[model samples]
Target: MAITQPEEDIEPTGTKTKWQRFKSKYFRMKMLIWWTLLGVALGIILGAALYSVHPSSVVITLIGYPGELLIRALQELVLPLMVFALMSGVFNLRHSGSGTGRIIRWSLLYYLLSMILAVILGIALVFIIRPGRSRPFAANNFANCNSNVTATGATRADKSAVDSLLNIGRDIIPTNIVAAAAAPNFLGVITFAIVFAAGLITFGQRAEPLIQILEMCNEVFMKIIYAVIACTPIGVASLLASTILKSCSIISLLKALALYVATVLGGFLIHSFVLLPLTLIVLSQNNPIKVIRSFLPAIFVGVGTSSSAATMPVTMKCGEDYGCVPSIVRFVVPMGTNVNRDGAALYEAVSVIFIVQAHGLTLSVGNVIVVALTATLAAIGSASIPNSALVSMITVLQALSLQEYIPDVAVLYSVDWLLGMIRTATNIWGDACACVVVDTWARRHAKKNGTLPIKNPEPPAEQEMAMGVDSSKKDEVI
Candidate 1:
């Protein structure tokens, strides 16, 4: 016989070496992280050097254009992703062992509990830290920025807390679904999705083909987001740099706002890294670190993007990949992106407290409690978009009739983009945790009802040990 090599002996055609594969697959992503860090470093350095430059200068504007485009792209993806992803979620719940109604109940319960806890934590932290009020430099140094911010907020803040709360509910019930869809009101769009999904589930088996179409649409949107996300390093660098260039003076900005920044970020770190992870441990009865590791990809993406609406696809994928039930993954994640805003709730409460304190006012125990409650409600009404918290912070400020204090919101606004990323990442993590909780409940519920279809892995090995199969027999079978 000819000396011919076996197929296994031959190297696979078109297969790249390990180094080349790593270069192709991970080079851009690794670069993205390093560049973002570099951007922040460079931003602060260049900002200090260029403090004399005006924000509207051609160079700053051009550098900012990429970041602006990224925001616009996120806006474009928001509506369709919410509608179709939620539709897919409902579709899966209806088909999976856990039916749609049960998943909805699980989703809402987790969402509400998360929001309430987050709001309370946020208010309590700000109260204890006393960031803005303790700092004298910030109030005295940024007179122009503060004045401009005050003028913008005063006009819209005439309503009381009660009035704002009442109006917040009304915004959820949009006048026309079409207008909501086009204007891309996340709350309205989410409501429309639920009703439409309920109608489809009413069709039962007939909805299968339509659900497949939606599944495909969801995948397409996810791919698009991934592609757009690759551009984030440049976009983030541009955005942060632009923010720096717009500053009146770096030393003044830092001295004035350092305490407020620390308070907000410290609270987020405590909540996200400590309290929230501990809650996950209690709920899932699993290693919280392992659970968090499963979702790191999505978390990083959310941090980069700073919008839950934009981060939905990655959030959904993370849940599924973590082995959550399909129904829970679909329903819980989409709904969570819209409603499970633990971090946003926390941020808004802190922002309100920081602003109130910075303006040389104080809230009593009763008023502090009320602000916490109002902040939780406002977060529910707010879109899962960047700077929407600023929009709703007006309601909280107006309710207190400290509309004059609104100007200091500008200090908070100075670092909103970077702060938005941290909070948004925390928000996505909450949503992922909710998925795990819902999945755990659904699995238990299904098992109780004897409908759970548990997939058996390493069944052969397990049975081998249990049945005492001989090694020879095992080898023969193999």
Candidate 2:
């Protein structure tokens, strides 16, 4: 007989090599890098093309509308799923009686503190960098671009700082859930989810069946999300191709583009890379680099899509993979994606300052305060829906009665896709950081209390029976 090598050895090695290649190809890092470059090129070319066209044409609107529609479909799924998933998860934890209250309190405190710190850092950076002072282009070039462009007939109004704050508070509560859901207001969805989740928890074990059903529903919804993400490359390609077809000389808008890009990058580096990591190291004793490394996929998708809502599923997955409890990831990340917008907050602040300085308008102390408050509230009020920020930013400017000085919102709209990616990436980074902090705290608390954290204990009878089986087996062998 001819010498026959062991088939098993050859088969296993070949299989292993194929599996390794597959994993690397599907790795989030590779996906992120490739998609992000595609998005950037598309945004620059399309933005320039849109700018070049004198009068708005039907072709530009046709190509742009599909991208906008895809964003809307994505937004429709965000709020209901977030509400259902978060409420079910939170209520489940509450039932476990495993120090969930402490975790929630700590996470909330971190979110609030981080928001304030982001604002402070943004204002300080704007003052230091003086991004407004770098007037590489003539003001005249942008003057025609400054005319007020509003869909609604509302004119810019003059309002006191107090009035603006009151308005923001008033808008937070949704009068009708149906209306809010249809329009897809994130704040309203969050409010509804928290209340609903709290009610389920208060009912205790009586709500267990309902919670289980909701968990099933959450899984179904996630599968739907996966399907959507699979189609991302096609949506992205159409969006980019249309952008390129419209803009011929895309390279000319580099100066203003550079300023906008630098502001976002600088802010993200400081908050995500430096400030947030330092906080985690000191308070939670976790390695900052490990946390960053764990969140690479979420960060990449966030930047690529520029929609925090779009990046939610990936963010949750990354958090779970990084040793976070599923309950924590389910609850914290969705909420953080909507409310904790460090990058968007920074962008709004810097953009307002840049616009004012560009137009030679000096902001008073009161104006600066109003800008900060407006940016924070606007960031909070932003619908997780795509392109919603464009409209919302206008509302914010109008709220401050500063719309006239910064009348044309389209100036910022031009670079919105690019900025959205950065903002979403920062939001995901914050969410991952929150997960790590909360997980570490929960683990330490459980260890100190001499109890297993959030996991079911073995039944006494089952434990004894297992021991008896082992003893009997040993006797037989002897």
Candidate 3:
């Protein structure tokens, strides 16, 4: 009776313990969210107040130092995180052959469709809203801008969309893997990880030790990520305060570019809020608003860092809460970080047209087509780093042979910092949605094709035994 009594008592105790843990975790997440929002609010207020005092550049740098450290910490982890996550995720796959291909096809399809919609929407909005029509270009408009900003026109004016595409292909098959990693070429690193994992899988049991090691490494990195995530509120506050301090003179620039800013913000709002959620609803029939709410932490991180790659860790951390399997989140979100740049596409397209309109010039129908297509391609080729789209925009300009107005691109730089954050938030949001959508689609497709295995297929007895429950007491535990 004593033995049976203890066994019987185990179930409720375990259940209660798990419930307590759940509540604790849920409360922690809520607190993190509230604290992060508070940081943003405080940072903005601090920046605004300091701006009136005309703080020195040295003070601004000091204020932003904490945020800079956070960025470096995240950046240092990105390569290892991508490599281990990809390998470990592939190892978890039941059938990498068909399963991997299906996931890739769906990911690409989602990226392509989303980028096109965003680009088309931006182009339509720019033409309809005509933000640039009121702000005709004048030489003095950019006179206050730094020479470096104006000189960006000549920086990458030589690289067209074709060159960018070729570079991407070359990056995928890097000759020196070390050089690629050193260059932090994400595409190359991803290719190497995938191939290495495939080799391990091909060896079957022979590679089990190495695969297990990779899995352990992945878990260790995730633990480290959790630690980093806990410091996000502090980092976000410092980042925002520094950004505002740096752009203290933004009020005049904001007034100058208010219409243009409104147009871009309007496009981002429509795509992220209306179009993306609607797509999630129609495709998966899931409550996307809830998903978006779950992803707020990642979105806020993106805003602070202004880099999708930097925000990738946080995005994946939120994936479980977003109801996506780790495998889908690992594979889809990383790839989306590189290729699925709806926000960049939208921003580039609108910027190109807005620049043209601000100059009191109109593109030919052919040139407009080229701008839209190049913007889409350029965005895909863009690095998932801060202000990379600004560099990639050079390709769109060169494609349409609009090099003369390249210097005019600098005029937009005054506001690029603010716009960069907005676009990055949109990009992170798209990546999160891609994970959910791809996971749902892949499951449905696999089931329809009769390839889906029953989830948690093992019997309760075995599962409990593996979990350290006494086999004789498994029935009672169940």
Candidate 4:
């Protein structure tokens, strides 16, 4: 919690002081979440109004630059943010205690399992929805079919999933770290960061300086990102205006977008509500709804901002308040936000399949598997940016030789505002959900195995929260 200074004790600085005080009071997870939603609602209305007016290119350019700038700013931060934050966590391995190892191991195991499952779910949903199919059959959502079924039934093995898998593996652990950095291979970059950070653990306090610097660098990136993100409403309004004018106004585009929008949002709904909550319940044996409600403030912040990195503070804070051990909440949410974007991974997977289907291409088991792998990579590559998944989706499309279909899939951005919010919120929710599950699983095992010292039992959860419980708080059981 932020400390409050007395009104009389503080010196006034005109508009700056009022702004500072306003930020101090309301610039928190709870309030920011509401502000962001307002931005969305207001932007939508403004966008529609502006489009109706047929604004000139000069007007459009001026209005749209803030939104474009926010994205560009985030793009610049993604690489360094991932590198510093993940490396910083790995460097703290030994000092964070024995639990840190399992936290990393099990958290990662769960992250991959959830992501794989999410992608599979997305793939299955896309198969059913067939968003990228020919407009006549797809517009009413398979109500009348067959014209677009030509490319739906066959699976291609020409590219071979095995070869693609091997190629990705080789790229993950590159021969030259510098070369990987220069080329900006996110997988290899993260791999190198993990290796170097682990090596640094051996130096003990000697590594402290570098770790502190990394932490500072991470903070710097965060501040910059958040500052840029505050302009989201302006950007959203401009993008909405442009999108409505260019994309939604076309009848062909509208028909093409119906199923695709439904598919992306449907995938987000299932992943956010069914898949993740169930995983959290099965692993931690906690009430998934209550867990989500406890962190709803933070999740909504992610929804509003559409950036997980920007939602980190709220997530970490909410996780701790929800009874996650402070250490687990602190480390897990930060690192997980950086890497475990389950929703984005699922979106990427669905987008790739959607594009291929739209292009009337033959389907293959190998192609499906390749998409799954590439989607996961893309999720990691563009983890930190909102509405930025398409950038990495291009990478996946190109890998499968589907790059030429990019223009065909451009309709996605028209509805990306809401789609981005839902997906971003889901991504942040998954991190907090994983934190609770991991904390529960780790502490339960630690207690049984004598690694964790036993303490007083926690009060009833409702009673504790009602009483503002602090002293008797303990990690929940699985």
Candidate 5:
């Protein structure tokens, strides 16, 4: 060996080997995985133990309240950031002057069609899963815990179709902008932001300063978002443990828990694995699996954090890495985070129906349709943050008077964190799908204009060179 060492066998003494590097990297990832697993395990254990010892303890309240507060704080950051980011993105694309019209048309079409598909799929799944029919959950317990019915009010007041439609229209446009911003209606904020950004963009040179300022504000808000996200695991653990301990019973958990879990998981599977991909394939003419693989990390983070807004940066980064056009990713992902709530829609519809059936409420076809539509629209109006579901649910129940039959809002208390996680996952998936659809459209336009390379094009010069073929010979062969 000393006489003649093979060139491939040579090694440097000061540098670490590939195996060593891999080990270091692997250990770091492993530690993170183990830490997360430990957190979840502890949460489950504490939750179960607390339920057994005392169903309603002050300790639970202390932990639960702060966790809830933290979630609200995170939510408060989402609406403005989303609006600014999305509008900025859209304005940038418009200014680029490259197929802006086509991009806008395709994006709008894809968004609307995909949402309709998701709604239909959600309704179908809710009916098929029938998680609510497993057992007749005690009406009083459910009413006491989950009801939106007030003590003095009747729960069964029927509203006409005309009234419901009018109420929806009124709620969409807020009377006071300040009040809306203070409460943080994402849709309202988005409406304001889009008009603001559009106006700023129209001013050209005069708007330059304003655009710069808005961009700076967006950056600052993102920093705040990051700080908030850093605290998520602890907040989630506390929230989950406290909720489980306070509201869930071992008997109920054993009986209806599986049904709840199945319905959620099943709905997610159908949306993520089936409906979303098909939409991408059909509309964008792209490979859905590729989009999914690219978005996996963001999806995981969204599920863990239970927030699409919190996951926005990661989602945008992932979209760019996966070859999504910046214009499309920036516009569609942020907007989808706010409005494209496929998962929330699915979960809300299923949960409402489940609760109703569990309580042995005889729901007519009209009731089911109303619940589905209400859930979908309510989810759209919901702020893109954590723990906003209860508020949104309150609005929906009030509108429909479903709360009259169920008097207490406490039933949702036990599973808020779990449902939040599921909803967040769903929201993230919808955003990813939106990116795919937008990217497909952008790429196709780019290709048509000869900006992007053609798919399955002829071999590059290097490959031809390696094959010992001259340009002239290659042309002749072709």
Candidate 6:
């Protein structure tokens, strides 16, 4: 008697081949994190080797061109990505109605609270470490600072706290949408997206077609972002290499900034590892370590790119992979990029105080209060781009009537590349934590009220192909 073939043996050859192809693609995607790590290591090694030989400007530029291209490509994607992501998220939340407002309020409260804690931690650390005491900076460093200032025709005027508040107000309500987008006034862009989405929801069924379009656009942009992210390892390697070559001559400056660096880094470590994680655990009851492990891909990209705005796409993807609902990921992450800048606030607070101590000036109680307030406000208003903190730090100094010490800001800028990377990583980490908190809260609130739709189960295989690499899936995928 003839026996029927086994089910596995009888599977369609074409279907079997498709599955094999998917598995291969999945393997490559899963290895991206490891490839990124290798890129960082190679970048350090190559950069260090070239720095010893004193690479010329042309060489540095040539090595860094690909990185510059990567930045431009990511920036090109940011405005559209932010708009679509925010609008889609809001439209989806329209089903929950009042729940939308609650999420927004919760997001803002978390942003404000986290940043305040970070600033407080930074201020305390700087006072304890006293990095600026004894004016550790060398004479040549001052000369370099002064000459750079003069050469650039730099001028500073004291700005009142009220002016800073007014500037933020103006940015929040841009007269021209095109100008706001071009100015890359992200806060304005964010304000517009939220309002536009609200208007769409107001029109109800009339806006259904538009909402579908937005969801489709978001999917398309996300695909484009993944294509760009595929190039991250190469881009990161070039960026790090160029940065190393540029900083080769700053060996002495690094030594002088040792204590200053320690204080800043110490504050960041506490904020990132201790305070933020505890917030996640206590508030969400989710394992912080597991969440952080899920966030590793975004963290590495943020560190390499050094711009939270640039890293937004990756952050959103990671959030989704970690099982956060897309609505929360899209809304909270974009807002957090602009508002929840714990690292920037912390860095600015430490910086102004360190400068005061370095210049041998005592801060009155009023001045210290001003520093804390201005640093917090400035960070809230700062752009999510590289080196933007430097501009906001000026506001802090001017508010405290420390314009003379403004020139010393140049010394800090010299080492900002390294610090910028570390702080950017911290900022991205904080954003992920905020997502966890908001998503958990929203799920619970929805459950109690029975108003909001529950999140779906993990996406299907096609969607799973785009998911962030998780620590748990390392064996199966990697």
> lDDT per model, in order?
0.62, 0.58, 0.68, 0.65, 0.58, 0.69
Best by lDDT: 6
* RMSD in Å for all candidates: 10.1, 10.4, 10.0, 8.9, 10.7, 9.9
Model 2 regions lying over 4 Å from their true place: 1-56, 88-92, 98-100, 119-157, 182-185, 225-253, 277-478
Clashes of each: 2, 3, 0, 5, 7, 0
Sort the predicted structures by lDDT, highest score first. 6, 3, 4, 1, 5, 2
Candidate 1 local Cα displacement, residue 39, angstroms: 3.9
Q: Top TM-score: which candidate number?
A: 4
lDDT of 4 by residue, 294-351 (tens): 9999887777667777667678779878887765665567668767888889988887
Lowest summed lDDT window (length 10), candidate 4: 136-145
lDDT of 3 by residue, 87-135 (tens): 7545654233342566767777888888899999999999998876643
What TM-score would you give candidate 6 relative to the actual structure? Answer: 0.55
Candidate 2's TM-score reads 0.55
lDDT of 5 by residue, 62-86 (tens): 7666467655664466555555565
Q: lDDT tens digits, residues 163-218, model 6?
A: 64566657668999898777656556667887998888888788878888887897
- Superior by lDDT: candidate 5 or candidate 6: 6
Off by over 4 Å in 6: 1-99, 136-256, 453-478
Model 5 Cα shift for residue 177 (angstroms)? 1.4
The predicted structure with the larger lDDT, 1 or 6, is: 6
